[model samples]
Target: MAAPETRWLAVNGAKCRVRTKGTGRPIGFLAGLDGALTWTPFLERLAGERQVIVASLPGFAGSNGHDRLDQHLDWLLATEELLRGAGLAGADLIGSSVGGALAADVAAVWPGLVRKLALIAPFGLYDEGEPTFDVFAVRPGTLQNHVCANPENFAQATAQPAGEDAMEWQVTQLRTNEAAARLLWPLGDTRLALRLPRLTTETLLVWGADDRVVPPSYAGRFQKLIKGKTTIATIAGAGHLAELDAPDAVAAAILEFLG
Candidate 1:
């Protein structure tokens, strides 16, 4: 496949890097914790069938301005602008982890913009009875184990570039973590349950049966709260970052839903 065309655009006052590849009906993808520094095999597979647009959120992948968003409303508005700026209006949307929560918010508040939604281990709900894993507490050396079903997936995802690029890569990871922590620290819930009932878009919740970050059990809660058509697809032997652990399976599930 050809390399994704890349560009920089201003989103909610932050400079964001946007990458686009393939050619067909467009699909917008909001990345999770890592900020989509590079497109993975899973995204490449999706691109084979349709246009895939991935954007690096503020403070991730060298993008800046995450500190500007201090409240949930700030995030919501920023996400909406990203979709519109990327020419993803009315397109099928996919979000993972924190991105999933934002996508759910957009689907609820601006249903007309997202034709369909898919969330992979999305963060937005906190069930004390079934406490989610504390990502912030995990040491840097062990973060991979907590987020990936296969620790090697995490290693690959976080592979340090060689030579001069390595230092920049490390700084980028730190920025990404800080950005994610700003939204997910303490508990990841943003009172999303109250707004989920307002979401009318068809939704698919994809969970990794082995997810430790947001436990697969949380899928049930999402299904219950989303008022529109919603279903769950559990990928066995996958964890929080299932797309990295089981790219083909994740891609297949998303493609089926998009179809």
Candidate 2:
């Protein structure tokens, strides 16, 4: 696969990093707490038919500070600005984990901005019976265990170099976690249920059967909230990061939905 071209854009007075691949109708992808680095395989698959734009959230990867975005609504506005700045205002949108929640909010608030929506284990709702794991509290080595069902994918995603490189990676992860916590800590709910009804685009909700971070049951909740055309799929033997745990399945589902 060809390497994705990375570029920087100024969105809402913050520098945002965007990786573009292939060329065709635009598909904007929002990365999760771990960023878009691990989704290269998934993006590569989608790029074959459409232009794929992966944007890192503020404070992750090459993006600027996240502190300016104090609330989930701010993040939604920033995302809107980013997509418009990148000429993807009406692109098909896909997001995972926290990114999913952001994508949903953007689609709801600005229904025309997203032509179609796909969310995988998105974090935006809280279920009392199936509480989300407190990822911020988990110890370093143990956190990976809750991320994905496949051990091989988990290992590859969390692998790090030794010495200074390891330290830098740790810092980057910490910052990313901090940014995610701003929207998902304590309770992962952003009251997205209220806004979900406003989404007019066709929506796809994918969940991992073994997702511990956001619980698989939330998939039903999402289905109930979305007022538009919706479909749900569960990837067996997968966890929170369904795209990483079952990349081909997730990619196929996304392409099928977009088509």
Best by TM-score: 1
Model 2: how far residue 97 lies from native, Å: 0.6
Candidate 1 per-residue C-alpha lDDT over 1-259 given as tens digits, one digit per residue, 9 for 90 to 100? 5678998889877798889999899989988776777668888999999999997777767578889989888888888888888899999999999889889998899979999999999999999999988888877588888888899887876777445387788888889889888877779988899899999999999999999989898999999999899989999989998888998999899989989
Model 2 residue 103 lDDT score: 91
| Backbone clashes in model 2 | 0
Error of 2 at 78 (Å): 1.0
Off by over 4 Å in 2: 158-166
**Model 1, which residues run further than 4 Å from truth?**
162-164
Model 1 residue 239 lDDT score: 92
Model 2 per-residue lDDT tens digits across residues 175-207: 777888877767888899889988888999999
Clash count per candidate: 0, 0
Q: What residue pairs are clashing in model 1?
A: none
lDDT score for residue 59 of model 1: 78
